[model samples]
Target: MEQLKLAARNARKKTIVPVKQVRIGEGFVVIAGPCSVESEEQMLITARMVKEAGADMLRGGAFKPRTSPYAFQGLGLEGLKILEKAGRETGLPVVTEVVDPRDVTWVCEFADVLQIGTRNMQNFALLKEVGKANKPVLLKRGMYSSLKEWLYSIEYILNAGNPHVILCERGIRTFETYTRNTLDISAVPAMKELTHLPIIVDPSHATGRVSMIESMSLAAVSAGADGLLVEVHFKPEIALSDKDQQLNPRQFKQMMWKLRKLVQFHQQLAKQKSPRGET
Candidate 1:
């Protein structure tokens, strides 16, 4: 845990990770986009939609890691190019997952924030590669990983000299089969107490149902999450991946409206709290 000294929370301050021009810990950021970049039009359309709905950043997978080999494995470098174009056209910083260590530099060239997916959460080589790069990293918690293990993984990045790291609690595997993964809403405040890194929640992957995302997202904010990573698609019915959990444009906007209020309330509550971790 000592290795994570820079990321650990203290009585004085919280770590603020900056990506592009957006200050993550300073405000409640909403990062929304499709699960995968299916086409140039898909990327641009969703990017515009999310941005119009007040999303702070755009998220799309260029190199998707799937359970089945026959599934849509993303559009690779072409997808990255389209994501970059969409970000430029919309003026939103883009975030994409980088699974392999070899693609770090290429992904960094286009992505404002490099994401380490759940499957690659403990990929030490990939973590080290991204840690060495000069970009913010969004490290998601592995489905099977414990909270302590998650902190140690962050240590790997902070120890490697990159201070810009964001902790994303995307849910963990539990006995429940009703959702893709159990939404660990408690992890939000727990992590806040354990580490200074800004923490965000991924309700899209947590519940794996459109109807549950809104509730879980609100719960996350109430639990002290710094932001959210949501999946939004123009037409989720025909999405390439994670269609069931991806919120359509309308749903996303509605959720954003609700989230804005929740964020304000959270900030107000924070202002009333004492500096010594007291309310």
Candidate 2:
């Protein structure tokens, strides 16, 4: 019996260690911004609007990976500089995706979090490079990868001496014509059970339709997502990339209002269910 108790205590310690000490959303963190940093003016305007809408962090792509070589490849360092300026002005942490291992240092210098995009989830060298940096990282699940593969990709970061990691569910590729990608909602609950890391859902990328973002985002919260990462643009139709997934200012504000109500309700319910005689 004593031996069994000792084993159980050790297991508990391991679980407890991983659960705490990670920088994450306190309630429901909202990360929002444009799909790409078109110019200084565009990034600044969107940053201010998202901050006004109660977003916790801002997201923009400094280096875009396009399927076609002729497509726009983002503004690179200039965009990061613009993002840094916006972060300074708005007091919100900035998150930007890095596509190359060589740019890790420069990217980490400005952005609060380095996003490992879906296409680069399996980029072991790049993952190792970011892992060595002092900044936090957001790892997005690959469109065709399994949940196990996704979590193990996180292991690459944690093992490289950084514990500040976040998991993003950005949907997976499927044959459905109705949506851009099929959302794996069950992954939220499953991840909660398997890991202590915070999980944020990207309904924007999952559905690829602004009209569907609100519904999918609400559903993610219902399934216990820790936060949301959405694309917010002042103008969507003329945006450089992924215009279909971007939300205008008015729509984002509405979603934030509804999310606030849901968060409050959940907090109250949690309070009411406290264990007997517990604080």
Best by lDDT, which number? 1
Tens-place lDDT per residue, model 2, 192-266, is 766767788999999999999999989888888888999999888889999999999999999999998888888
For model 2, name the residue pairs that clash. none
Candidate 1 runs further than 4 Å off = 10-12, 271-279
What is the TM-score of candidate 1? 0.95
Q: Give candidate 1's whole-model lDDT.
A: 0.92
Measured against the true structure, the TM-scores of the candidates, in listed sequence, are 0.95, 0.90
Q: List model 1 lDDT by residue over 4-116, tens digit each.
A: 67667766378888887899998888999999999999999999999999999999999999999999999999999999999999999999999999999999899899999
Stretch of 10 with least lDDT, candidate 2: 13-22
Residue 213 alpha-carbon offset, candidate 2, angstroms: 0.3
CA lDDT scores, all candidates in order: 0.92, 0.86
